[model samples]
Target chain A: MVFICSVATAQLPINWIDPLNEGVLQGRLADNDITGYNRLPDSVKSVVREPVWALGTNNAGVYVNFKTNAKEIQVRYTVSGALDMPHMPKTGVSGLDLYASNNNGEWYWTPGDYRFKDTITYSFGPVKENSHRIYRLYLPLYNTVTWMEIGVSSDATIEFQKEEESPIIIYGTSIAQGGCASRPGLAWSNLLGRALNTPVINLGFSGNGRLEKPIIDLIANTPSRVIILDCLPNLTGVTPENTERIDSLIQAAVYQLRASQPNTPIVLTDHSSGFNKNILDETDNTLYEQTTQAGLASFEKLKQAGVKNLYHLRNADIALDINSTVDYAHPNDFGMVKISDAYQRLIEQFLR
Target chain B: MVFICSVATAQLPINWIDPLNEGVLQGRLADNDITGYNRLPDSVKSVVREPVWALGTNNAGVYVNFKTNAKEIQVRYTVSGALDMPHMPKTGVSGLDLYASNNNGEWYWTPGDYRFKDTITYSFGPVKENSHRIYRLYLPLYNTVTWMEIGVSSDATIEFQKEEESPIIIYGTSIAQGGCASRPGLAWSNLLGRALNTPVINLGFSGNGRLEKPIIDLIANTPSRVIILDCLPNLTGVTPENTERIDSLIQAAVYQLRASQPNTPIVLTDHSSGFNKNILDETDNTLYEQTTQAGLASFEKLKQAGVKNLYHLRNADIALDINSTVDYAHPNDFGMVKISDAYQRLIEQFLR
Candidate 1:
C-alpha cells in the first residue's frame, strides 16, 4: 500500500473512478440500466404511480464513497432533470452535496461551499490539512446523473474499498426521497448512510411511495441491514373506509420484506406531521387525524399478529419543530440533520 | 380592562382584527402601501440590488403580537408574490409562521401545519391546554402579505398589545431575510425578537444586503435597540482593487448608523463561510479571502477610531457545520436556531 501511494502521487488529477463501476453506489436502484442511477427499472417505470416515477428520476439519497489523500477533490457529472420547485431544492435542480469524514469521524461539508451547477468539474480542496480522508459524494436530489467522475489532486492517492452487500434499504415518500433540501447529501438517508458508514438503497418513490406490491417485490429482492418504511405521507387523504386498504397495503409490504430478510430489522415510521392530535388545525381536518390513526393502527396490527423484529418510530421528533421543515411536508438541511440523528439513535442497536 | 374581557368571551369568533390595522405590525417598512407590506419603498426599489428588493418583498421578522384566551388561533391572509427559489422555502414563497408563549414561558408552534397560497385563512387550535396566551404571528420571509386577519373560536377572546417603537433593528443578507427556513419565525431575527420580546426591524435584503448610503440613511432614521449588520456574504467576490469600495461601504454604513443612533449598539458579522481559513477549497478563491480581509479591516479601523458600543460577532458558528446551510449560503432552520442561540447569548448582555 505504501509503495502504491508513492507512485500515485506522481500522477496529477489522480485517476478518476466511477463508483458505480466499483459497486459502492449506496442509494443506486437495483436493476438500473448501464447508468447506475436510472431511478427505477424501465420495466417498472410504467407501473409505478405518477409523479412518483417522474420525481423518482431525481436521485435523492444516492451517494458513493472512497478514500483519498489528495488535498483537493473534484467531480464531473450531468444532472438530467430540473424540477425546480420553490419549496424543495434538493429535489428541484441539478446539484450535488459532498461530505468528508476522517478515520470514521464526523462528516462535514467542504469549506469552499462545493455546490455545483453549469460547471460539473467542481473541486473542493486544501481540505483541513489531512493526509488521507474518506469522502462521500451525494448525487443531485432533484436531478438524475447521466455519468460521473470523481478525482483528487495529482500528488494524492485514491482508494476504493469493497462494497457492503446487505445495505440498509429505505422505502418511503417524497420526504424520504429528499424533498425541499438544498442537496442530496442533505437528505436524511444519505446522512445516515455516512453516519453509519453503510450502504443505503433508497426506494423512495416521491409522490408514489404508497405501500404497493410491485414495489414490495423490488424491496424484497434486496437483502438489507434494515428496512425502513416511511410511507405515511404518501398515504394522505384516506377516508374511513380506506383504513383497511392502508392496513392491508402496509401489512403486505412488511410481510414481503420480512419474509425475504426476516431477521433484518423492519422499522416503520409514522407521519412526522399529524401525529400530534392536540394541534387545533389538524384535528379539525379529519384527514390529518385519519392519517395518523392509520399509521398507528398498522403498527399495532403488525405487532399483534406476531411480527417479530418490528421496530416502530411512532413519533419522530424531526416533525416536532415547525421551523425544521422546509415546507410543512419536507425537511430542509437542518431537519434532515435532525432526522439522521433520530434514526441513528433508533437504529444504532441494529446496525452498529 | 376587565370590562372588555367580559364581552370578548361572550362573542363567538371573537373579533378577528387585522394586526396591521390595529397598529401592532412591527418590522414593517416605515412607510408602506394600503396593504401594509412594502417589498421595497418606491424610491430605492430600483436603486437597490436586483434580488434585494425582490426578496425584500418577502416580509422577514415582521410580526403582530396579541394576548388571547381563545383555545384556538386562526390566520387569514393573502400572500402577494411567489419568488420560489429551489434553495429555501422561507424565501421561496409566501407563508406565515406562528408562535405562542404564555406567562413568558417556552415558545412553541401551534399544532398542525398551516402555510399560505393565494387566498389563505388557516386555523390553528386545540392548543396545549391553556387559557390565556401570548401569540406572535410572523409574516412571510420571501413573499408579501396583502392583508391578514387573526381570529379565535367563539368561546375565546383576543387582545392586541401596544407595539414597541424602539425595536431591535437587523440589517443583513437573505439569511437575515429567513432563507430556506420552513417558516419565517425560524429566522434568527424573528427568534431573537421573541427571545427579547422586542419588535425587530428586518432590513435583510437578499443578494442586495451590502451596506450602502441610501440604505444606511433609512436605518439611521429609526430609533433602534441595536443595529445588526450581517452582509459579509454579499461582499464575497470582491476583487483586490475593490477592497477600498467594500471598506468604504461597510465603514460608511456603520459610521452613518452610529451618527444618528449614537448610543444604540451596532453589531458587525463576519462571513460565515470563510471563518475557517483552514478549509482547503476556499483559500484558492482570493476573492473570498479579500472579502474577509475587507470586513476585518473596517472593523479594526472603526475600533481604532474609538467607535463605542460597536459589537462584532466575528466568525459566527452558523457556517461551522455544512449541515447548517440549506444551500452553501443560506442557513436551514437548525442553523437558524443555532444562530438565534448564539445571538441571544451575545446580545443578552445588551438587550436582556
Candidate 2:
C-alpha cells in the first residue's frame, strides 16, 4: 500500500490497433445496427433516448488482447462527442476506461482516474512487469468509441491474442450494459468475463432489453458456451395485463436459442428486486410482483415443455441489501459485483 | 430482519405538504437567488442546463419537522419532469427520495425503494411507533419537487417541526449537491447533516460552485455553526494557468465569511482525488496539481494574514479507492459515503 508521490513517466515504443477495424474486433459486435455498424437498430435506436443510444454504442463487453514484453503500456482513443450532462460526471461521458490482468486472471484498473473523456490515453506499468502474459482492456460503457489504439515499448514483443471462439453471453437490461458504472470493466457481465476466465458477450440494450424478437435472433446466432437472459426488469414494465406478451417473449426466445444452438445451456433469471417492497411506491411494488411472477411462470412453462439445457435463477437468490442500487433499477458497483457473484457461480455449473 | 411476505394496505389518515408552494416551505429559502425565489440566480440560472438548475430547486439541506404517532407513514411527491438520461440513473433524474430519523439523530430512508419517481410514495414504520417523535425528510436531489404530501394512519397524530437556527453549512460543487447518488439521503452533504445531529445548509450548485461573489455573499449572510468551502475541484477546472482566480476566490470567500460571522469557524477542504494523477489524462492531472497547489497556497495566505478560526483539510484525509465514482469526478454511493466519512471527522473538530 505504498503510494509514491511522484514517478517518472516511462518512454516506450508501442503497437496500436483500431478495434472497430475489420478483422480486429472480438467478443461482441460493434456494428450490429443498420446505421453502418452502430450498436442499436436504427428503428429501435430512435425509440430510446440520446444518452442511452450513445451508451449502447460503447464497447462495454468488447475487449482487446495483446501480449507485450515491455512492462509499461498506454492506450489512446476518441469519442464522437464528449457531451457533458449536468447530472452525470464527465467520466461516464466519453471516458476511456482501462482494465488489465496477468496470468493470475485477476483484473485491475491501471492506476489513475478510471473514467476520462474528450481524448483517451492511460499509461502504466503492469503489476508483473517482467512477465509478458496476455492483457485485456475494456473500452467505455456509456459513450461511442470513434477510435482507439494500444502502445508498448518499441522493442517489446507484441501480438494480439486470439478471441474466445465460444464465450458466455449475457443479454439483459442496463445493468448488463454497464449503466452508471464508473467505467466499462465494472459491469457485472465484464466482471463475470474476468472471473470465469473466458470471453463473454454483452448484448445489453439500455431501456430496450424487452426480449424483442430481433434481439433474441442476434443472441441465438452468436457462438456461445452458455446463454443467459436477465431481462425480467425490462420485460414486465410494471404490468401483468399483457400476460400473453410476457409468456410469449420468453417462450419464443428460449425456443429460438434452442432451435439454433441446441447444446448451449440457456439460463433464465427472475427479476432481481432492485428495491425493498416494504417501503416502495405502488408502481414499483406492482413492477416487482408482475415481473418476477411472469418470469417464474414462463420458466415453469419452458420446463414443462421439455426444454433441455435450461436453468432458472430466482430473484431472491442475489440478496442485494438496501441501498445497493444506484437508483432502484440500476445496481451500483457493489451491486454489480454482487450480481457477478451470482453469474460467475451460475455459469460454472454448465461449464463443468 | 423479520420477513413479512405481504400485508393488507392499512386504512389511515394522511398529512402532506407541497414544499414548492409559496407559503408551505421551512428551513431552505424559497427565493434566495434573484431569479424569483429559485435557488439559482436569474442570470446563472439560464446559463446552466435545465436539469442542473432544476436540481438546484430541490429542497436539499431543507427539512420539515413533523410529529406522528401512527405506526406507519407514507410520503408522496411528484417531480416537475421525469426526464430520463442514459449516463445517470432514474434516481438521479426525477426520483423523490426521503430520509427520517428518531431522537437518536440517526437518519434512515423511510423503508423500501428509497429511490422513486414521477408520482411515487415511500411508506415505512418509525423506529418505535408507540409515541410520536420529530421526523425529518430530505427531498429529491436532481429534480424539481413540484408537489408533495405526507400520509399517516387514522388514529395517529402529526405536525411540522421547526427549522434549526445556526446549522452547519456546506458550499461546494456537484458532489456537494449529490450528483450520482442513487437517491437524496446518500449524498455526503445529507449524510453529514444527519451524522452531526443538527440542521445543515446545502448551497451546492452542480457545475457552478466556482466561488463567485454572489455565492460567497449568500454563504456569509447565512447563520451557520461552521462554514465549509469544498469548491476547489469545481473552482480550478483543468488549468492552473491563471492560478490567480483560484487564489482570489478562496481569499475573498474567507474574508467575507469572517467579516460577517467572526465567531464561526471556516473550513476549507483540498480536492479529493477522484483519479490517480499518475495514470490520469493530462488535463485531469493538471487539474489535480493546480487545484492542490492553489488550495495550499491560499491557505498559507489566509494564515499569514492573521485569519483566525480558519482550517484547511488535506486531500489525503479522504481515501477514496478506485471505481468508487459513478464517473471519475462525482462519487457513486460508496464514494459519497467515503467523502462523508472524512467530512464527518473534519467538521467534528470545528464543532467542538
Candidate 3:
C-alpha cells in the first residue's frame, strides 16, 4: 500500500472535442449533408413550411454518446433563441444534460454548475471514480445549438460510441419536442430511448406537425423500427372545420407511412389534454373530446383498410393528471415521466 | 320559449378587491403587524439572521381564496426580484397560480396568458360557466410581491373566504420553500394543504433553515395542528464538525418546541436527496449519509427521552427517482408531488 501525489504549478490544459468528428450522434436520420446539429437536413428548408423548417433546427431528441475518464468535463455552446420561456426553464430549453453509466449498466445523472451568457457554459467536474465511463449528453430541446464543444482534461482518454441504426421515430407537436420539461433528458422521447436502450429520432415540429405530405415524405426516408404520429393536440378544436381537417390528415399520414415502410409498427397517439378537462372547462372539453374521437376513428379506419401493425394509444393511457403539466399544454418533468412510462410500456413490446 | 339578449357597446368596468381587506390569506401564523406579503412578522426582522429574514419576504405557501361570478378575472402585481431562475421558471418563481372549484367540490386549474414586464399582469378571463365559483390563487414561491390587485367584471359578485386557524405548519429549508416548483400551487406544502383541506404555514427559509432558536420560538407561537421540521438538507455535510452541530440543533429545536406546545405532534423529516446519490457521487453520498444518520439519531434521542407523538420520515419514503429534481438539491414539479404524496400519507392519519 503506497500512494503517489504530484503538485503542478500551472492548470491542466483542456482538450476540446467536436462531436461530429467521431462521436455517435443519435436521433438523426443521416450524418452527411446536415448543416448543423439539427433534427432535419438542409434539403427540407425549402420543401416544408417556414415554421416547420425553423423548428427543425432545434436539437430536441439528439444526443451524443462518448466515453471518457476525464477528471472534469466542460461544455461550451451557443444558442440561437431566447434562453427560456415563461413556463419552461433554461435547463429544458437550451442546456446540455449529461448522463453517465457505470460498468454495472446503471445510469446516473451528473449535475453541473451552469452559467448563461453570450457563450453558455456548463462545468461537470471532479469525476469521482476516474475509470473510463460511458456518457450520453442530451442536447437542448427547444433551442438551436449553433455550435458545441466538449472539453476534457488533456491527459485523459476518450472514445466515441456508435448509434443504433434503427430508431423509434416520432412525428408530432411541441409536447413531443420537449416543451416545458425541466431538462432535455426528461423529454418523453429521450426517456423512452433510455428505457429501451435504443435510439429515437424526434421529428416534432412544434405547432406545425400538421401531417403535411412533404414532412411525411421526409419521415418515410428515415430508418425506423417503429413510428409514432402524435399531431392531434396541435390541430384540435370543436368546430366542424377542425374535425374535418384532423380526420383527413390522420388518414393521409397512415397511408403515407404504409407506402414506404410496410412492416414498421405505426402508433397513433390521441391528444393528451388532462383527462378531467372535459368536466373542468368547456373550451378544453370541446377541443379534447373532438380530438380524441377523430384520432380513434382514423385509427379504426386505417386498421379496417388492411393496415397491419397499426396501433392507437388513447390519452387515458398517458395518465396525466392536472398537476402533471407546467401549462395546460406542456408536460412538466412529472408529466414527461407519465407520458414516457406509457410509451415505454406500449413500445417496449414492439421493439422486442 | 322566449329568449332575449342584451348588448352593450362599452367594456365592462372592473371592480378591484384587496385580498388583505377580506380574502382569506392562508399560511400566515398571524395577520397582525406583517409589513407586506412576508411569512414572518416585522418584529422578527431584527431578531433572525439577515438571510432568513430576507427569505421570509417570499410568499411560498401563501394563497388567497375568494368566490366570484365575474365574466373576466385579471391579476395585476409587481415582484421585487429576478422574474425567474436559470433552473426554475417564472411560473414557479413569481407567477400567481389560480385554481377554481365547482359546486360539486371538484377543483380545476384555470389556464391563462401572462406577461412579465415592469409590472406582471395575468389575465384568466371569460369565466365560461357564468356561475359564482370558489377560486384559490397561489402566490409566487421565490419572489416578494410588493403590491397586488385582483379585478373582476363590475357587474359580477365577489366574496372572500375565511382561513382556518389551525393549519399544518412546516418549518424547514428550500424544498419546503418551494425552491423549484413549476408553479406555486405545486409546492409540496400547498399540495398537502389542498389534499387535507387545511391551511399550511410554510416557514421554509431557503439556505437559512438551520433550526435556529429564534425561528423555533416563532414556530412555537403559531397555532398549528402539526409542526414539521425538515431542515436537514440545508444543514448537511460530511465533516464531523457538521454532524455535531446538526445533532445539537435538532435536539434543541425539539426541546424548545416541546417547552411551548406540550400536546402538539411534531414531525422531523430527514434530508431528501435522490436515493441513488450514495452510489453516484461521493461528495453527495457523504453529505446525505451523514445528514441522514444525524437526523435519525436526533429523532431517536428525542423519542427515547419520552417525546410523545413525534414522527420521522426518511428520504426513501418520499420515493424520489433520479428524474425527480431540477438540480441535485431542489425538487422540481415531479419531485414536489412525490414529497407532497409522502407528507399527505403521513399527515392525513394524524389529522383524523
Candidate 4:
C-alpha cells in the first residue's frame, strides 16, 4: 500500500495574542489554617523570578488548547529549566490533584488521590474520555490556588471528538528548561504550544543537558511533532572528541525518534554568542562555523535519507548582541524575547 | 605644592612592558610541564599523575607576565567550561591562589600566599611593598583544563598609594558577574582590566545580582575607578515602586562612594535590547529608553551640580547586532572582545 503523506497546508490566521499570564501562584496558608505555629507554611511554589516581569494569560486558549478524535485523551505541558526545588519532595503531605476540564466546564477527577512530583515534566494520557479539554495546573502543597495565565491557546479547526497520538517534544539546554525567563508560560516551548495550539513535552534540563545517552533515551521513548536539540552553549570548552560524541548522540537520538515517530522534524542549534569578536582568529572562526555547518549538514543528510523534516538555526539570527548581553553570555530579558521570537518565526515558517 | 601628576604620567610607558612570560603565562595552564598541577610543593620529589599542563612565570613580578608595572599588572589565562570541577567553587576554598613575584624564581614563595578568591570574585590586597611584581594563579581543583587568563593590579595605585580611595564598583546582574564567557579571561570585566590597565574590583553576581541594598552598600565602601550599573535583566518584574527604589539605591551607593572617594566616576547603563524588531512597540521602546535616559539624566543633574566623572552608556551604544551575542543576550567570544573594546574605548574617550 503506497501511503501518500499529505502535508497539512492549513495556515492559521495570525491574531494579536496577549502574553501568557506567567504569574507565580503564591502558596500562602489560610489565616486560620496554621495549626502548628503562628508562622505560615513555607509553600513550595514555583515563582517565576528572574527577568522579573508580569505575564498574563489571555482568555483565548488558542496557544495551549488542542483537539482530536479518539476514545481516550492525552494532555501535556512543557516544563523547562532546573526544577525550582530539587528532588520533588514527597513528604509535603499535600494531595496531588489534577484539575482538567473541557471548555464546557465538565471536569473529571482521577479515581484515586495521587501524589507524585519527581519529574520536572509530566503528561496525563488515555483520559478514558474525549472532550474539548482546558488544563488547569493546581498543586495543594500548602493550599490550592488556580494558576493565572497571561495568554491561552487560540482556536483550531480540529473538532474535539477523541484522542490524537501525535506529540511535540523539545530537547535543549537551560533556555529549554526556562532559564532567566520570568515564568513557565513565557518559555519558548510553552509559547510555541500556544502558537501551534498543541501539547508539547519539554525535556530541557538546566546545566545537565549534554545530549548524553540517558537524555536521548528519554527523547526516544516519547512521540513528538518535532525535536529541538539546543545543547551547544552548555557544552562550553567542548573538545573535538566531545563534539563528535555529541554529534553521534544526536544521531542516535534522531534514530530512536524515527523508530517511534517516523518523519518527526528535528531542529538543531549552536551555542549563542559568548566569545569576543576581536579575538576570533581565522582558524577559530572557520572551525566554529564548520561545527555549526556540520550539525546542519548532518540534519540535511538525514533529510536526504528520507527524514523529510529537519531544521537548523544559527545564534546570529537571534537577537543576541555581545554588548547587549547582561553577562558575557546569558541572555537578559531583552535577549530572551528575541530568542523566543526567532524560535516562533522558525517554527511557524517550518509548519507552514 | 604644585606637584606634577605628570610624574605618574611619565612612568606610563612602563605600563606597556610585558610583565607576564611573553603572554604565555596569560592562559589558564601552560604546556611546558607534564604535571598539570601548578604551584605544586617543590618538596615532592616524585610524580605519579603528570598534570596535563604547566604553569609559567616571567622575570617581572606581574602574574602571567603579559604587561604590568609597579602601579598595575595584567593577568591572562584560558578557562575550560568543560573542566572536571566547577569554575569557582565556594566551600573550604577561600578563593583562587594568586601570588606575585618581582623575581620570577620567587613566585614559589610570596608572603601569605595571597588568595585572589573572594565571596563572589577574585581579589588581591594592599601591596605591602611597592615594587615590580609578577602574579601567579594556582588552581588546585581544576582537572580537564580548557582556557586560561591573568589579572593585573597595582596595590600602590588603587589601595596603598591613596590616603582616600574609592573603587570603580560595578553592580548589576550576571553580565556584571561575567556569565557565559568561555573562560574567566573572556569576561568583559577582565577585558576591561586590560584596557584600563588598572586595578578593578568585579562584583558581578550571577543570577542573584539584584540591585539590592546590601550590594549597594558593598559598592559604596569600595574605592572605585568608576561605578558601572547594569541590572535590568535581573529586575525583570520590577514595578514602578521597585524601580524607584532601585534608583534610590543607586543614588545612595553613588553618594556613599563619593563621600569616601570624593571625585570618583560613576557610569550607569540601561537594558540593551527589549522586544526585538518584531514587536517594535513604540511605547515599550520609549519606556525602556526613557527609563535608562532618566537614570542618565539624574546622574547628569548631579554632574551639573559639580559632580565630576559621571556618565551613562545608552542602550543604542551597548546593543550591537545579533552576531555579537552567543544567545540573544549573552555575548559570544567575539561579542566579549567587542564589548571589551567598546568599554575600553569608552573609558579612554571619556573616563581617562
TM-score of predicted chain B versus true chain B for each candidate: 0.85, 0.83, 0.94, 0.51
Residues B124-234, candidate 2: write the lDDT tens digits.
Answer: 554355243466666666666656777776576666666646777788887887776756667788777777776677878777777777667766777788888988877
DockQ of 3: 0.54
What is candidate 2's lDDT per residue for A1-352, written digit by digit as tens? 1344334454444656555553445456433544422455565564565654665576667666666676666777777754433323344444544555566665544543332545666665543443535666666665677777676667776666766468788888876877656456677787788788887878787666788776676677676888999888777655456666788888989999999998999989877763453333345556776778877888999999899999887667675644456544666665677788887777787787
Residue-level lDDT of model 1, residues B1-352, one tens digit each, is 8999998657464556777667667676564542366645677765666676666666777777777767667778887675465555423446666677667566656633454446665566655556556777777787777777887776666777656468777778877887767567777888787777667888887777888766787788878888888887787766665778778887888888888989998888876655543233545345555677788888999999999998877564444566666545666666778787777777887764
How far residue B222's Cα lies from its native spot in candidate 4, in Å, is 11
Docking class for model 2 is: incorrect
Q: CA lDDT of B319 in candidate 2?
A: 68
* DockQ of all models, two decimals each: 0.31, 0.11, 0.54, 0.02
Residue lDDT tens for model 4, B143-218: 2223333333333231112112233455655555454343344456655654555544454544445556555554
By the DockQ metric, which is better: model 2 or model 3? 3
Output the better candidate (1/2) by lDDT. 1
Q: How far off is residue A352 in model 1, in Å? A: 2.6
Compared with the true structure, model 1 gives a TM-score of 0.77
lDDT of 1 by residue, A95-133 (tens): 666776666465557633444455455566556556455
Better of 2 and 3 by lDDT: 3
lDDT of 4 by residue, A1-352 (tens): 1333334434334222211231112111122332211112122112222211011111111123323322222222222222222111111112222234456544432211222343222223323434455443332221111221122113322231222434466665555554433223334554455456555555554565566655565566555667778876555443677556656766776777678766677777766553334221233334445556556556666767776566777767774643232232344334555676677777777664
Q: Which has the greatest lDDT?
A: 3
TM-score of each prediction: 0.77, 0.62, 0.95, 0.37
Model 3 per-residue lDDT at A38:
82
- Per TM-score, what order, best first? 3, 1, 2, 4
